[model samples]
Target: MKMVDTMCNMHLHNYKDILEIRRNTSDFMWCSRELNLTKSYRQYHDLTDPYKFQYDVFRSTDIQRLIEEVSKCNNCSNEEVSKHVVEILKEIGHTRQMAVFRCFGLCFIKVLKEVISCVFVNEAQILKLKSEMGGNPVIFVPSHRSYADFLLMSYITFHYNIEIPCIAAGMDFQSMRVIGKILRDCSAFFMRRSFVDDQLYRSVFKKYVQHLVTYGDAPIEFFIEGTRSRSAKALVPKFGLLNMLVEPFFNGDVPDIYFVPVSFSYECVLEESLFAYEMLGIPKPKESTSGLIKALKIMDEKYGNVHATFSEPISFRKYLTQTLSATLDFTKRDSVEESGHCFHLAYQIVDCQQKNMVLNTFNILAMVLTNHLMVNSLEPLLIDHVSKDVVWLSAVLKTQGAVVQPISHGTAVSVLMESIKVHQSLIRVSASGTISLVKLNNDKCKTLDPQTLRGHKLSTDMMNLAVPMLTLQLYVNPCLHFLINSAIITVIMQQVGANSHINKNSLFMKFVFVRELFAHEFVFYRPVETQEFEDALTKLELLSIIESEPLRLGNHQKLQALFCNLLYPFFSGYLSVCRFLLTADNLEWEERQFLKSAQERIEEELISGWLLQPYCLSLDMISSCIAALTSMIVLSKIRRGSQVHYKVDKDRLIPVISHLESLFYLPQKYQTRDQDSLEDTESIQVISSSEPLQRLVSKL
Candidate 1:
């Protein structure tokens, strides 16, 4: 393996060094000869380091100050513009290598000669698109699906004889040790996750993009949901990059910057089926080298082929996503927060739960096909059963005459069973041998807690649920229900104790406070009614975040672990900060799943609560519970603006009061019910109590 790799790598260096050099350049531009002038360079060094060559070539030139010099130009001096141009060129170069590798695997370079000799200009129109790529270094924004997107696009650019374009990828890729080091040496730039929040980093990265945009060949590019869409659709556009593009337009710094929407259709994505299964909560370990070899062997035993289509471009930056909001017929008001993430163009590829794959004919078909099978009593069906909603998917495959083996109900079921055995998803014995797709949390996620500032490693089962609705094609409706159920945690919280006397009117004020949020976060959608969503108060009461619970559960109960994991979503913005009424045996697996998926929704709601003050009454019992809910000891402290020290009880509550006068309760007409701690204990056995305050805590 090492010998083959070394020989292949050496071969890769010889054929593509100049082009490779261009890819590695930060600001330098070169004629083919300047790039191809490696005879002396290679011989002088007696070695090949893509990075060393890149830095040496560029540093040897005057490109370091290229941007500074360009910025001095009144005719064309936008730092942002220049950076994008340079970045695009490099992105193109790196993408080419990746593209070849995808097709030829580890032997890409070894097979390159044959492929180039045989494969003619695949698409002439694609080859001559630069003239049409108008302004702002035209960037092709396509929905993300598999990691193979980078390669497919690069191949198209190189085949078309177009100039290599630089690509912008996340820093995570650059962190892959030697591979990352080599990629950085190529044109791929390092972008930190924090760059999304910290504008300074964004500015620097944006400036780099602008520079690249002005320097390279049509700077071929696509931002995969800004990062990589995990769900099978174009996720929300990270307007941050879009905003940078818009800067030139708004300032008249450059001519029109065109944004062409490219629709990519894949018959079989290298990562499609597995990635889909994974994101759908399937527990398959990543295909290791040996596993990949095994899969390849299987592919050879069957048939392997791929077909892709590049849709006509959609341009009109003036009518970008923000300008054209999609109005789905169904309303998921509870998932307004997740909806925001959906709208942002940038994405992060974590576990299947965190990322969304790009949507295409295959995924759409997969979903329709899976649902048809799952609904038909878990009997997998043929593509013949594909639904009209996802029919375009079939068309995409049929047009290319796909080589995939026909899947009958029996065969499909068999394969699905095999997938489950490998842990791509799970099969539960509940409901007489029901299959539920689930991904177990790995060690990295199992030990985390978003609540503990230092313990961000998520508990496994809970993390499993927080992942987005990647299998949207299969359980779109069920997913919606699950989200709706999870969303209720905060939505109906203000009214948890129906008979409680915490002023009803004021209670309404402490809810939803909906704002920009993703739909898949906290809003779990289930196909049917679920108690986890239905029993909001019971969960909250148990969480001890609400002072209503008489006795908190022993931390070791299965319920406590479940609640902690599920509630992480609530705290982390899946559900808005609210209380769940937790109690003994309050939820089953169905309920737990609903609770787990509510993180994004809860987080968004928490934001709204912060901005809108969802905790309407200063005396909200839940807030007090939140103060004392953790295993940490509850402490007495002075209110932000008050003088007297307020003490919190074991349920983690501090008495909330309103000053009616300079020295009296604020609501002078309000009556006070002075009851002892023991007096309110009776409310536990019954669902409700008569006292106004007690009722509010118990039933109201």
Candidate 2:
């Protein structure tokens, strides 16, 4: 729980302090000095000649098998297959040179001092993991946030004096000239992004990874999310790489494997700007040496602290045993069944990573500040107001069993001010000591209202908001999974009053309904578990927000306000998208066509002052909402030749939009009386109209 300062002013001399903290803390146990490498690993690397080891054992059998498989197709000669195998080996294989690793380790530490303020590790869990590593292959499955993730894993291991892992990097990096070679020298192996039709390459790559797990002694490291999370939330796990890494244990080639779910939290993501553009449907630039050289200029700027936390090791043998017990004859299962098992395992790892994520001071502050902007408009938020909200949020998170960063209420404002300063474009402070959102540049702004010259394009506002809010959203995204249950309960309680005799079955059904509505808007690991729903109910009862006997609820005014703030972005975004969809000229349209049309209409609405929060214009989230509508039969899918089209059912969608709008719109009384009223109060107007459906249809 203590912070480690690795600043350069200290001469990079914090090792003694780290060691002392480890000694005092019961959670961390240092590894034995004599056991740097396992006996088998030592024996393998101790050969007098490097070529002898390579000739006898470096994926020879797998390469032969791949060559034979390729030769069977008669697609190429034996010599060609052999040459392909050689190229694949060079691409996927790692050279574990201790001297090279040490050199890179020192260089990484020095470079990190310039780029980041500090690097924090969860020492106790890491030490425990190291202690348990000798019996099985150890795998580190970290959430991929940046290119920095790959180096961070190796850096931490080397810092701890443990054997460095062989990292699985994308083939994009392998093409980066000197950087690629240096990465390989530092024990990184590359894999193609997709391997659908290339069976020869697939076999070679798969066998290369298997050889590492089964025979190589170093721990294996890979991203379970498969790639960086573009939206900064945990993505549904990608099973391709996880399946290959775990296959050794399933095939009995290795006794067992231990997976350590690692979570990383950064104060400032290096690629935040690029990720924002990608979210707007722009293609990400490919990795290149020139790009690397250009990026080096930013090295002079400071990116804040990063925290890496490791969770308890998950035993693969035990998990498989438990999972297969019901099958009765797992060994007789087909490839499909095996794939299913791998998918289940992938989900389990994702869940583990989610739970391991530590909500730091920066993310919590971002959540409070973002919500403030959403409810209060772009006006300057009082410093005291932001600080008060942060305290409230931190308390709420702690009660829900989340790991909140330890910051006193008095210090919360300072922390928030620091975070805002890091991303200067997000917020601007006035001379009067109030904070306001920085508007987008005039060149980037598009006129939504041609007549008045006041209309702004949705993309313009989105781009402007993306500068500050997108990065803020990244910090807030991790906590959404934790807050969703409470959010649902609060929304339900508000809808169904304390005087009503609510049916438990009906209540749970409604909860599920709301959960599915925003499934795409939020990163839920899976469907809401029954136990979680029950727990939420119990929590409500304890807080007197609801009663169990008659299933009644309480007023809980403060709780309602808190929940409303938390869910505003998602609920508002969904409602806005649905409203835009209803304006389409044709009901039946292909998905891509629908999205393009929706984007245009949304921008038009933004110009017309129909949408309030520009950050809500997420294309992916809009698509997810459409899919959810499809699932609920509010939108029907129609097949037009080879294309899939959607037909919106206005009859069903009207009530859905009304209910969500009610949840999203904040009451005028909720705001401080002194604050100016928002000009774009169109949402309130829509909800208050007696014939809402008729009004919406006429406007369209």
Candidate 3:
């Protein structure tokens, strides 16, 4: 990728830098004084005031009227309603004291600096957004990737002189004792994970959020995804909080709300281990103050650099005006209709978040390195291959409209080396100077079935590799979404061959099909416009990756190989799941049970060296693939006694599996046709069929 000049020079700050900056700047006292001087602020200056205000809003005459109207059928009393209001407030409210906010902000900056090297990218966009903030309530919707995400947004705004936002935080942190209280004081409002059945809490929380947007001067911040993404890519958005935040704009309480989508890319995530466990179907540990303290013990380790890119602000008023051409009259709508409208708006916001995500050097490097590792080709040609792939990826990202760091051919190795050092524990260099992943030596690996240990007889070595590869997959995950369309087209071209009459509609259908198949493996936002496939094909032709006239194609054998390599894991995992479903005696199985069995089966495949696609070991992706299959009618779902069970349809199942299996075979020029047999092939095979698959078997 050609490096372009960024608005601000990248700022790299060490842990001690925070202390030095704190000592040099005495603005804390001034900030505290400013906090004390304002009357409205004073009224809510105590740590408990915001919570009380939320209760007041809930108990307001309007809310009481609505509650009475909604609950009259049940003969609920005013006292009972009042009691419910208190419970709702306790669950959803938070207090913000300027003094406490300032203190925590300082400490947060210090702790963040100590733990990770933070880099703020696209500052020019942030400056522009900041200048445009005053007329409307600004909402900062950053992609959530790790626990550190909570602090990064606040730190960036404070560093740039913007007011710290009133953040919406999950109730998971509410139990963190002193930390929880401090977070509340620092402008974080705790929210229940789900309020589906709690109408009272939902109503109260909605009003509280609306109050903030209408009155609060500071910007409002919350993750569009709702929670930290376990897979490290943007999750399908949870619309509840987003709907609540945007309601004020539609209600005409606020003239407009500007949403700033921020994307955070990490060289190494603080919650990598936890996320890995969660992906393996292991339940995450509950959040607690003691756990937080224990986690702090490992703060001294290096976490490399974190890049936060702020995309251009999106106006909610303008968006709604465009989406809903008619004047909106929220007053005329029922609760259900209003919710449906809000969900539609939430989807638009999610799209903005997805587009705003910038792929940086760290993630790109991880992807390139991980692909090489998966193929066992990193040893002899590690530096050379990584360098070439990085350059290729840079150009590809640039073409895809991502803001990649300027990487010269000379510096690519150094950049990758830095990444290796940052994730040193997961990757290692042997005495022979060959690179390999650290093997799992834990009790967890020991208990795994021997059939799952493919190449290694011992469980420890198997796990060491499996665990690190899974973590590496997290870093690689985000990049896949960007490359999916191109990958689909490239793979199809290789299958259909050059000089063949390729039907555009058929190709588009195939693109959609492959995209859906890997939906769980990669989280991608489906574009509203149908032109994405056409656009990708057009670009590929322009780049000579494919030819339009006579439908000839370029020799993208190397490129096609890389794309196949990236997809191998998902295909293998899906194959394993399908195989398991085929053999299992139970025609119908609960979702959780099926997922557990699929994971165990994949692990066994990995251990027995039967599955060469390391990335396929993820239980999250397996579960998602199963859901996708059900949607495709390859699997039928039956709800029995409150539990959903799935039964595979043999007819639908065969075609879908065949299509996925075909993706593993590259064009002939890209492989050796004489490869011993299908059994000897590692991850993918060379297609030798006479149909479309045989078209490209000839030498380049």
Candidate 4:
């Protein structure tokens, strides 16, 4: 395997490169019973007393002052407000006990070994980060991909003798009966999904977070993405918790606050099936102890390796002085804080997270298969073609600075076969030696109720095809960040004519428009657009895919097709919204009603052969399109009581739709077939691989 740069901190480069020196263990050893069971008891443990911590946070001057201030504002007695604050603290606080921590560590290890082959972490970098943990508070902002993410970090810290961070968890887990109390004992603090209207709760939560930051004994951990990304893409960072985190540094409570962006990449997530169903308009099952027991059946299966990378630690103090140039005035007590500064800093952490993401073989292989299925839907992919395309795509991603795992020399097919074996629940190879996606059981959702769906209800026919296809696309979504910019250029040039010349100015204009159009769908560091654009051009030039001087096209036809086809579904999904808006020029619909209308309209288009991509059946993308349109002012939003309604401004929408339509065109071969293929969902089923490497399936 080829090694990539694992360290992101410049100062840490002076240390000996340990990541390069450490040899990767075999998959068998990664899942070994002894490895998972072993523990180092002699390590220093600086665990905080949860009871004292809570009392400290409650009695802190910040919380007391805020409580008094809120009581005065509400014209209430201080005692009443104090009682309310105490109740709020109990709801949100964590209770960390060393006994529970050690006991849970063992249980988590057993659970983890059952499902995952390995958890690959850079020890040297983690030790370096641990050394820098003193004198100020630290925040570990890891990307959220799975429920397992919450457990992994705490386990790692315990193994490495570092203090376990007090994690911010959603209230969904807080109601999971005994499991909730256990998690709290393991240092997981619960917070509501949204407390925007509850001033007392919001103030208490902020003060609780600020107290955690100010104490400087234990690290505070939270998902900068705020929630698990169903699509597995880096979400636009949430500002509520982030604003609270940095407030201390702005007010001189801490000299510096360190923000570490940790990226977790899974070969396959435990929630793959659930996320797939949820994306196809089915509501996610609520978190509960009963549900937890039901999910234990998945422990019999094997999810491949996971890579957790700790990127460079960002100092708020340094960033304020260097990046923002003291744009935030700390002296002005009455000055309002602009969200733009927070946004810049948040995106910076997200960018680091993306950069440090470790792409497994399955990620690249899935993308190759998705690209193939776009052109030849009925055909199975040959092993040779799969191997070649995997190599080609891996090279493409590496050139763009993506951290793709290297294909072993001359063993690409075997490596890919192993990946397919690990993810056999998702894809399969036949006795004929050709690979295809495994069809989701059509009868699985027969008992599903329509009214319970979180989004528009779809027919069983759509669900059969949409579920597995979207699941396949979920693996492909992580690679989108590396491909989106260049792919946009490819589509633009394809519109102008593949071999035609276009000025840089004209290409950039189209690029900016499309970027803004999908702003809600993907993460784009808005402050650095010019630099991102220039970097995309440079990457394309380095790959010999395009020319820089006067902006001419290159001869890399296969690479161009890869880019074009990879992003085609997204454009198709977004275009459907534009076409829908064109028809409903003056019509107004409530926000939920608008989304349902758009989804139903798109389904009709897909079935009637007007739209081709089945992957475009994403409710997330449909909602993201509406959000983008509203932000762009192509659709005007108005409030009526508790409901929000949208009206399309045809004048502004026409040009936008025209531009979208200009960039989008589907060839006949790539389009969907007639409605006859939709008669029975069973016809979509394909045979599983011969013998299917079931050795890994039944027993690791």
Top TM-score hit? 4
Off by over 4 Å in 1: 1-136, 196-200, 272-369, 372-700
lDDT of 2 by residue, 464-562 (tens): 554455556777778876777877877776667546767889888777768778765655534335777887887766655567777875544555555
After superposition on all C-alphas, the RMSD of every candidate to the true structure, in Å, is 19.6, 8.2, 7.3, 8.3
The TM-score obtained by model 4 is 0.88
What is the TM-score of candidate 1?
A: 0.41
Model 1's lDDT to the true fold? 0.33
Q: Judge candidate 4 at residue 336 and give its lDDT.
A: 33
Error of 4 at 350 (Å): 0.6
lDDT of 4 by residue, 1-700 (tens): 0112233642212223222221343333322323221111111333256666677778888788987898899999999998988888999998876667666666666677677776778667778777666767878889999988878888677656667778999999999999999899877898999999998799889888887777646677899998899988888889889999888877787778888888888898889888888877788888999999998998899998887888767877677556655465665534435435577778888888888788878999888777656553445567876786677678778777788887853889899999999889878888887887776557756787767765677777667767777888889999988889988887787677646789999999999999999898999866678777888888877765677666876655456556777877888889888888788744687887776777888777766656655677788888788889999998888999999998888889889888988998562122222212211111122222122212111111
Candidate 4 global CA lDDT score: 0.75
Q: For residues 1-700, could you state the per-residue lDDT of candidate 1 as single tens digits? A: 0000000111111222112332345321222222211010012222233333333324422354554554565355556745653553343223234333233422432232222212221132343345455334556554455565665555545434454445566665654655554454434555555555543335445654554443333353646356443333333345455545434433344444444344343333344344433433334544344454555432322112222333333333333333234442113433432443223222211111111112223343334333322122224332223222233322322222222223333344443333234323322222334434443444545443444321122334333333322332322221222123223333333223333333323332332222112222322222112323224444445433233333222222222222222222223221122222221132221222323333233323323322111111111112322333221233344444423332333243121111101111000010113211111211111111122221111110
What number of backbone clashes does candidate 3 have, counting pairs of residues 3 or more apart or in separate chains? 12
Give the TM-scores of the predictions, in the order they appear: 0.41, 0.81, 0.84, 0.88
Model 4 CA lDDT for position 435: 83
Off by over 4 Å in 2: 1-66, 323-340, 377-380, 440-462, 497-501, 525-528, 578-593, 626-700
lDDT for position 134 in model 3: 63
- The predicted structure with the larger lDDT, 1 or 2, is 2
Task: Using TM-score as the measure, name the better of candidate 1 and candidate 3.
Answer: 3
